[model samples]
Structures are given as C-alpha cells and as structure tokens.
Target chain A: MIVGERKPLEEIIESLEGAEKVLVAGCGTCVAICMAGGEKEVGMLASELKMAAKLRDMKIEVSEATAQRQCDKEYLDTLKDDVKGKDVVISMACGIGVQYMALNYEPMRVVPAVNTDFLGANLDVGEWAEYCQSCGDCVLADTGGVCPIARCSKSLLNGPCGGSADGKCEIDPETECAWQLIYDRMKALGRLEKLTEIRPPRSWKTSRDGGPRRLVREDQKA
Target chain B: MKSGSNLEKVFEKGEFALTGECGPPRGADLEVVKEKAKHLVGYVDAVNVTDNQTSIVRMSSIGASKVLIDMGLEPVMQMVCRDRNRIAMQSDIFGAYALGIRNMLCLSGDHQIFGNQQDAKNVFDIDSIQLINVVHTMREEGKILGGDDIDGKPEMFIGAAANPFGDPFDFRPIRLAKKVAAGVDFIQTQCIYNMPKFREYMKRVVDMGLHEKCHIMAGITPLKSLPMAKYMAKKVSGIDVPQEILDRMKGVEKKKRAAEGIKLAIEQIQEVKDIEGVDGVHLMAIEWEKKVPEIVEGAGLHPRPQVS
Candidate 1:
C-alpha cells in the first residue's frame, strides 16, 4: 500500500499564512488504512488548525471532508461541494492523490498535508516497511522472492558487499542484510549454485534513472 | 603482463606481493599524499589511494594517484561505485590510465551515513563485481560496458576486495569465486585479526582452486591502542578482531601499546605469509604511514622483490 504520514502541523499551518477559509480534505483508501489521513484525522486536523488560528488571533474558518479515494475523479467529485468557497484545500492523500486533486480542481490552491513515504506493507498496527521500489523490472524469482532493489542499502545485484556482518547491514545493525536473507532462502531451496552465477550490471532504464515514468494501457483506454 | 604494473610483475614472478594504502586528504593537499608516499615508496610494490574512504570527502583517488606517480611511487588507484555512474566511471578510468595509473581497485565504497555527509545521495549504479567486469572488459576486450569499441583501452590490472569475515561465512569463498569469474586479477581482503576464521575461509577458497585464478592479498591493520582495537571490533563493519588479540593489547601498558600493536601486526604478517592461498599482504597503516616501513621491515618483507 502507498504509505504516507501527515506533514508537520507547523508547516501545514504556515502554508495557510493568509488563508481565511480552509478545507481539510482526507482520503479513505491507503492513507486511511495506515491511519494517517482518514475522516477521523481530517476532523482532528481541522480542529487543530481552528485552535491555532484562534490562538494567533487570526480570523480563519476550517472545514473537513473525506473522499473514498482522492485519486479517482468520481470519488473526488463528491468533495466538490465541500471544496467550494474555501481559500485553500489541504489534501491528506498520497502524492498521487494530491496531484490528482490539484489537477481536477484547477485554479484552486490545493496543498498537500501528508508526505508520501513509499510503497510498503503494514507490518503491525503502526509499523510499516518498504517492500518495493517499483523499478519496472523485477528479479524476485532469482532472489527467492526477496527484493534486493528495495531491501539492500546499495541495491546490490551480484551478492552482498563486504559490509554484511552478523546478518545485518553495515549502515545499521537493526537492518537485516538483504543478501543474507537471499542466501539463506536460496540455500534452503538448494539453489545456492544460482548465486555463483555473476549477475550482470543492472540496466536502470526501468528505474527512476529513466526519468518520470508514465504508463499507457491501450486495452483499458476508452 | 596485464598493464605491466609493478604489483602485476611481482605476482607474475611468483614473488609474494606487498601493497600499502593512503587515504587522500580532505582537501587539495598534494603534500599530504606525497608525505604518505615517502613512507611507502620502496616499502610496498604499489600503494592504494582510497576514494573518499568511509565516505568522508577527500581529494579524488585518481588525482592522488597522479601525485604518487610524480613522487616515484606506484599507485593502485581505488574506484568506488558509490560516487559515480557507468559513464563517469568509464571516463575516469580513461583519465586515470592516461595519467599513468596502471592498477585499479574496484569497490563498493563505505556508505555515506558513516561519514560527515549523512544527507548525501549515493550512486551505486554498479556493484564491485560488475565494476571489475567493466574494467576487465575495457582492458581485455578494448570495449566499454556498452559493447562499443574504444579508441584506447585503460589496460588496468584490476583488483577487488574480499571479506572472509563477513556473515554467511560459507558464502565468502563463493563471493571470491564470483569476483574471479568476473575477471578480477587480484583480491585484497578485509583486515584479518581472526586468523582462524580467515584460514577457514581461505581453505574453502583453496578447495575451490580460486587461489590459482588471482593473487590474494591478506589485509593487515595494526591496532594502535585498546580503544582502537575495541572500535574496530565493535564499530567497524566486516572486520573480526578476535578476543585474544584484544586481551593481548589490554595486557600491555598504555605507553607500549603502539609498539605492541606493531609487534602483533608483524606476527600476523608472518602467520599470513604461511597461508597456502595467500599471495601477499596489504598493510593499511591508516593515518600512521610512518610506521609502515617499520612494520614492513619487522615482518621480514623488506627489500621488496624489485620486479622489472
């Protein structure tokens, strides 16, 4: 899921420097599951902004609204009434949803309230870890389903660098060395011989190195 | 003669090779490199000029290698993948070769988090093994990584690092084999304080016959003090300083610790020289270059084999 966290309240408040009317928009999908930008968070943020304005003796009014998913135009259309007459709309969605809201509500000052972190899995109630880098090309089969591109600090393909010690990375002892995991997994599967084969230099065209990516699906096009 | 470098010549003549290391200064101080080179001029066959080792910003390895070359010392110019992409790496190889650097060491540099520049972004476009392959292809096939022919190849004697102490210990030898397969001509290991573990790792390498494929140099870094020993054992990654050695250092008085450290290093060199697959010693007297000559001579590796 797309993981995101609310931006600092001070930064969010600072962005509304001269705004008199504000809307705290929320999303109900990825951000909601992660407990970051759900309806409850939207209400909390709106209340905090109101209190901040009152303390500063600013004449400001804050409203709250939640959409099923801000990335979709149909879901965003539901917030049209709530967005009207607002000095600014603070989007509490992932980066994609924030951009989508800004594009759909053209000419309106739409600001983001959350910082999109990464594509990750919710490990626990409040714990998440990055799982993939969305590098277009995947080599999970060879690595026993472990993603070295995301897990390894250096994104090493051939094998672990010399820094691997005690099954952890040199950067941080808390972080498990991704190649160790691959080695153990491959060993368990009796595929240790596969690791001996030198992996060629990765062609990073599929990664962010290729620049901002776009997808066109002719089959799904209208 | 693979670049006809002095280190290559030493290995070709079946003489035990000796290499030293010198980290470039944090600024453009050629005197700092030359000063270090003075201690290592005749002591080592080649000196490895590190590239921003530990990720602390320093004069580039290529630039420092030129300085060493000017001082009548051979430099094994170290290149790390963390700071450059394929294009930059290839370009620098040509530039370094053109400047008379005949030896190259490909490495995945220390992460930037360990250095002053914690916020810096890294560019590990290729791992060390791939970097070795890239250099090997440029030198042996006269082609760049893109498979395009080059007007003039770098013709470098490529080297790569090995860590017998890294975890999943059984796989250490396998990693060395991969590097050898990738066309590395030499291997300089991580510092070895745990001789038992290194011997075990080398036994596996010898079993795989990797020793015949490339020259293997055992790394030696004399522990200056108890704190230094503790730091290497606890803080440094991939280095295994045995408890006995730490105890040995602790047994000595504070004033004599440096001498004790040198004594221990010489002893290690003696032991390492006897290892079946070991072909040389890479003594890294980090920031203590003056002590290198003493340690090298004390180890009976002085009057280095003058290979022409």
Candidate 2:
C-alpha cells in the first residue's frame, strides 16, 4: 500500500495561512489502513487548525470530510457541496488525492497535509517499511525476493557494496543490508550461483527516470 | 583530441600518475582553494575538486575547478548525483566545459541525511553510472540525453569512483568492469588503508584486465591524528584499517601523530604504486591540503613528470 506521514504542524499551519474557509479532507483507502489520513486523523487536524486559528484571532472556518477514496473523480465530487465557498482545502490523503481534489475544484486552494513516502507494507502495529521502488521493471525472481532498489542504500544491482556487516547496512545499522538478505535467501534456496554473475546496470527507460509513466490499456479503455 | 589535461598526458605517457584532492570551502572564499592548489601545483599531475563533499554545502566544485585552472593546475571536477537532476547536470556539463574544466569524476554522492541539511530533498534522478553514460553520450554523440542534438559537444576526461572495500567483495571488480564498459576513462577508488584487501581487489581487476581498459588511481587519504583514524575506521564506509595501523597511530605522541600519519600515507603510496594493476595514486588530504607536498615528496614522486 502507499504509505504517507503527516506534515509537521508548523508547516501545515503555515500552509493554511491567509485562508478563511479551510477544508480538511481525508481519504478512506490506503492511507486510512496505514493510519495516516483517515476520517479520525482529519477530525483531529480540523480541531487543531480551528484552535490555532482562534488563538491567532484569525477569522477562519475549518471543515472536515472524508471521501471513500479521494483518488477518484466520483468520490471527489461527493464533497462539492461542503467544499463550496472554502478558501483552501487541506488534503489528508496521498499526493494523488490532493491533485484529484484540485482538478475537481477549479480555483479553490488545495494543500497536502501528508508527505507520500513510498510503496510499503505494514510490518507491525503502526510500523511500515518500504518494499518497492515502483521501477516498473521487476527482478525479484533473480534475487530471492529481495528488492534491492528499495532496500539497498545505493541500489547497486551488483549487490552489497563492501559496507555490509552482520547483515546490516553501513549507513544505518538498524536497517538490514538488502544484498546480505539476498545472499542468505539465495543460499537457503540453493541458488547462490544466480548471484555470482554480474548483474548489468539497470535500464532506466522503463523506470520513472525516463519520463512520467502511464498505463494505456486500449482494450479496456472506452 | 585526446584528453588535453596534464593528468591525461601523464597517463598517456605511461608513467605513473599522481593526483591530489582539494575540497571547496563552504562559502564563496576562493582563497582557501587557491592556497590548497598552490600547495599541490608542482607536486601532482592534476587536482580533484570535490562537489559539496559529504553534502556539507560547499562552494560548487565547478567553481573550484576553475580556480585550479587559474592556478596553472589541471582539475578533475567531481560531480555527485545526490544534488542535481539531468537538466541541471547537462547544463553544468556545458557550463564547466565553457569554464575550461577538463576532467570529470562521476559519483553517487553521500546520502543527504549525513549532511547538515538533512531536510533537503535529494535529487538522485540518475545514478553515477547513468551520469557517466549521459556525459559520455554528450561528448561522443554530440547529443543531449533523450537523444536531442545540442549546439556543440563538450569533450571531457571521464572518471568514476570505485569502493573496493565494500560488501560482497567479489562484486567490486565486476562493478569496476561495468564502469569501464560504461565509458569511464579513469577510476579513483576509495581510500586504501588495508593494503592486503586492496591488493586482492587489484588482482581481480588485473585478471579482468580492467587496468588496460582505464586508468585505476588508488585512493590514499592521510589521517591527521588518532581520532581521525578511529573515526575513519568506525564511520567511513568501505574502509578497513588494519589493527596494526591503528595501533601504530595509537603509539604516536599526540602532537607527532600528524607526522606519523603522513609517514604512514607515504608508505602506503610507495606500496600501492608497486601493485600490478595500479596506474596512479590519488592523495586526499581532506582539510590538511598543506601536507600533500610532503606526502608526494616522501613517496619519491616529486617534481611530477612534465607531461606537456
């Protein structure tokens, strides 16, 4: 799922500056499951924003609403009534949500409350770790399920750079070296030879570096 | 024309090349760079100008490279992929060339988290290898990245960094081979304190015949004191200081440790030059740029051969 974290209160407050009618919008999908931008979080942020506005003696109106998923135009249209006459809409969803809301509502200001981190998985209660780089070119079959692009600090296709010690990355000891994990997993699978050969430098044409990517399905599209 | 820099001439002359590193100051102070360049002027073939090394936000490396050029010293401009995107990188390439900087060293810079501005968004749009390919294409094909033709091509002597001490030891040389295949004309490896491991790496490099493909300059960073040695051993990545070297550093008098450090560096230089596949020695004195002359002199590489 897409993982995100709340922006700092100071930055959020500053982003809301000069706004009279502010809407704190939320997404009820991936962000909600990750505990980042659900209805509850939107309510909490709405209260804080109102309290902050009152303390500053600013004549501001902050409203709260959550869509089934702010990424879709249909869901974004559900808030058109409440969003009317708002000075700014503070989105509590991923970057897609913020853009979708901005597209649906032409001139009203739209601000993001969360910084989209990465494609990640929940490790434990309230714990999330990035699992993919969305490179579009997947090589998980060769490395025994380890995602080097996401996990390795340098993202070297060749494996760990000599700084791996005791299976931990040299930069961050708390993080496991992706190459080390690849080696151990490959060894257990009796496929150590797969890693011996030099893996070529990754081609970027299919990755995000090449350009802004899109999926065009002619068969499914109208 | 083949590389016009004196450093390239030294390599072309087939005599062992000796390069020194001079870091730019954090501000617009050109005096520090001039002072450092003056110390390295007659001793080394070329000087490498680091680009915001360690992400501390220094004066641009291209600006410092120009300073070196003004001092009658050749420069190898180090460009890290941590800061600029492709557009900015290509623009800088054209700018640096227009400014008369010749050599270029491609690097995947230190993560921004290690620097003072941890909050700064990193722009790793292209890795070092990709950066090399981009620069190589710009020079050779006379076209910008995305295959667009440019008004003129900027010729440069391409270089890249190699960390032989890092993990999955066998992959180090393979990575070097990849750099060679990617059009790296020269390679400046990570600093060498563990001669045995470096020797092993060089053997692999020679076996793969990478030395014949490109110039391999062994990196030699002098430790100023015991704390520096300890810090390198602990914090610096891809570095392994043998216990004996650390012990030697510990045995020195606090004040004399600087001299001892230079001595150790001299010994390493002499030893690394003897390695079969090694083509040159890159002396990185960090902030102790003044000590570079002594290291070059002690290593018996004084009055560096006039390659012009």
Q: Put down candidate 2 lDDT per residue, B1-308, tens digits, no spaces.
A: 45587788889989899999998988999998888788888988889999887779999999999988988989999998778877899999999999998899998888776789988977766777777778888888988777899887888899999988876676677678777777889999899998999999999999989999999999999999999999999887668888898999999889999999999999999999899989999999988888888899899999789866
TM-score, chain A, per candidate? Answer: 0.97, 0.96
iRMSD of prediction 1: 0.7
**How accurately is candidate 1 docked according to DockQ?**
0.86
Give one digit per residue, the lDDT tens place, for model 1 in B1-308. Answer: 88999999999999999999999999998888888789998999999999999999999999999999999899999999998999999999999999999999999999999998999989999999999999999988999987999999889999999999998898889999999999999999999999998999999999999999999999999889999999999999999888999999999999999999999999999999999999999999998999998999999999999888
* Model 1, span A18-115: residue lDDT tens: 88999999999999999889899999899999898889898889999999999999999999999988899999999988899989988788888999
* Model 1 accuracy (lDDT, Cα): 0.93
**Candidate 2 chain A, poorest ten consecutive residues by summed lDDT:** A195-204
Clashing pairs in 1: none
Summing lDDT over every window of 10 consecutive residues in candidate 1 chain B, give the lowest-scoring window.
B28-37
Per-model lDDT: 0.93, 0.87
RMSD for each of the candidates: 0.9, 4.4
lDDT, residue A35, model 1: 84
Off by over 4 Å in 2: A6-28, A37-115, A133-145, A152-171, A177-218, B137-153
User: Could you say which candidate leads in DockQ?
Assistant: 1
What are the models' TM-scores? 0.99, 0.81
Candidate 2 lDDT at A57 equals 90
